[model samples]
Target: MPEATPPPAAGLPELPVTWRASRTRAVLLPVAVLLVAVFCVLARAMPHNWHTNDRVALVVTGLLFAAGLLMLARPRATAGSEGVTVVNFVRTRRLDWAEIVRVNLRQGDPWAVLDLADGTTLAVVGIQPAAGRTQAVAAARALRDLVDAHATARHRR
Candidate 1:
């Protein structure tokens, strides 16, 4: 497991901070996975002689349920001195600070959007407005500050 924020420093800002998912996800994901696991386990322990189709169905269902659990982890964006790491529902990306052009968190938007220099954008889904106004805004500001701090340092050299 990666640390949310790196060790405290004297003057420089810390590297490696991550935006996590909502509390709802924190609570629901484990419970759902546990339930599915328990169901599969119990089915396996049943005394009845299971047919090949039944076993296959059980395996398929378990796999599908596990796949769905990935979303519960939600989107996480981690910032380090070298760059940013975005872990979305299905994919992960790493980009250096120079690749990012701007941080955008507009009203009515669900989360912070990072406008990349490549004419594309990256959504910071871990900092969702659905979590709460105060939290969402604070997260956006923190991310923006991180980007600004790095950008300023990079420009100086």
Candidate 2:
């Protein structure tokens, strides 16, 4: 298994780092564009006798499908010195480094999951294996390091 590169000298990574599922975006974006094009072509090909509303509805349904695909590609995470922001499909949440107890990306898992101090696990879609296992492992390691660094600092105070 690939390991993440070591953290910086300060025992913490650089602030304001962002992670995204590049593969997901690469796949979904083009599909979305293609869907729109197909819808336009289909709309124009509809029979002249068909109701305008029916044609419009067909186009609208295609648009909605494209939108849904875009949403699936929307997951990302940004980590700063203060906290991390997680943006999933429909919800966004922020958490301090101390709030994360562990960062796990086990084999066969779809994405990284954060074991929180509150005993809940939060899925981090941004660091998914869909992007590549090496990338996912590196991200999970880096995040774990950040959480550890923060926890250590907090205990000293």
Candidate 3:
């Protein structure tokens, strides 16, 4: 039988901090703005026979695009000794290592759920498996390690 490699040690291992893709915002913003401007121009230049639905569609699409663009432009994640910070555009949540009960890298939206001592789950959004399998796993392991270290340190204190 061939020998198998040993698994890496547990707890938040040192990792090169990585910033998730903000490109979605970068591309969306300009397109949204341009779309809004174009719609406005079209509405003004067209004859009175223009359909109301056209105007409504333009406004709704523009609004949706603007919102998406704004979201992408902001910071997504920052990992440190204390914990990982995640920003979901509308709100921001910070999870300390001690507060996290388990680190799961499962199917669907790739996220880390922090099971706080209080029993609430804080979802960390930016760490998606769709980003890349290797990178996602590495990040998950580092986060799990962080939680382990925090728990150990607290018990020792």
Candidate 4:
């Protein structure tokens, strides 16, 4: 009887392997503080004369700022031999390497994206742009390179 080849080791990396944003406090904290300031200013200026719609807008803006701040406060993404992990406020998703098809870094947008085999896209929002444009570009390229190398290495067997 002929011997069968063993499956390729589920080659993946270790955890605590984080891809974090560059300027967490600078980008998010300032915006959050600005939002609060705006809210206070609006409240002081309009006191009781503000319409319901205006009040709603202020509340919604405040919530958005708060959410942004929270996300920035703890920005991190990890990938291992098992899967890719993302952490955001009240939400987390893990995806196996096989699910990822390609990665792309678009200009103007704040982050890179992982194009999945299922026609879905996962945003790598954890990578902040403060590392500067050059670094951001390099990071995006590195991500795409890693995905390609991993996938190619797996299929070669």
Candidate 5:
């Protein structure tokens, strides 16, 4: 279990806190951007000897860069006073913080999972373990803190 988050002193924004996939995945956005730029530059500099297959290759490269950008978008979640949003590859889920029972990132788990009090579990694609154990654990701990703080604040009100 993680320790509690210290209360903010004053004049702090509490409505939005966003979490993303591991650093490994976060790095993809820039890399994909770079690749697209490089491909465009190379293609522009050397359009000679261009064949039908060359066009195909260019299309394929563009698609690859797009895919990389999509990969970067995978597994994102955000929290606020009201709820949390988890955006996975295919779908997105939003859950009120009060509905969440626990957040887990066990050994060998690909991503974080939120176990609801209702007994159904939802995978939080944002907090992934691929970045490294230390980082992943820290992320999980931070998430727990947010959940605890918000839930407690809600109960007190």
Candidate 6:
């Protein structure tokens, strides 16, 4: 069993709250740099008999790999007064407050999932446990509170 979260204060959270996976960026950024460095060194060290194309290929491959890693670090979510904008690895989606029915982050889940009124779930990678368990939970809770508060306000209007 779990305790209920209190309602957020009126006009709380101020709007445009943004969440990002800092840990993901921290780890991948250095790894990408290291990878590119290694590729450059390898390119320079290729056998004298090897063609220039081979060396170029190695460096190009490394750049592509680094780009992919950086993409994984690109997920973010921003909550504004009108809606939440979720940016995942390859796509971005915007959802109005009323369109979100629930926010869930169960144990073992990779990230927070927003259950939309349309019966679809959107994974919010910006609030992932891979960043930090406590941090992820807090972020998920805050987003949920924002959704709840907005819904309540809408109903009263």
lDDT of the candidates, in the order given: 0.75, 0.85, 0.63, 0.67, 0.74, 0.88
Best model number under lDDT: 6
lDDT by residue for model 4 (99-132), tens: 8898777677777778999999877776546546
Record all residue pairs in model 3 with backbone atoms less than 3 Å apart, i.e. clashing.
Answer: 11-145, 12-145, 12-146
TM-score of 6: 0.89
Clashes per model (N, Cα, C within 3 A): 0, 0, 3, 3, 0, 0
Clashes of 5: 0
lDDT of 1 by residue, 18-118 (tens): 77667647776777688678767866876678876786687677767766776756688888867889888778899888788888889999878999999
TM-score of each: 0.77, 0.89, 0.60, 0.59, 0.70, 0.89
lDDT of 1: 0.75
- What clash pairs does model 1 have? none
Q: How much lDDT does candidate 5 score?
A: 0.74
lDDT of prediction 3: 0.63
Of 1 and 4, the candidate ahead on lDDT is 1
Q: Give the distance in Å from residue 12's predicted Cα in candidate 2 to where it truly belongs.
A: 4.6
The stretch of ten residues in a row with the least summed lDDT in candidate 3 is: 1-10
- Local accuracy of candidate 2 as per-residue lDDT tens digits, 63-124: 99999999999999898867789999999999977688888899999999988899999999
| Ten-residue region with minimum lDDT total, candidate 5 | 1-10
lDDT per residue as tens, model 5, 104-145: 989999888998979999987778878666767777877777
What are the runs in model 5 whose C-alpha is more than 4 Å off? 1-15, 41-57, 153-157
TM-score of 3: 0.60
Off by over 4 Å in 1: 1-13, 41-56
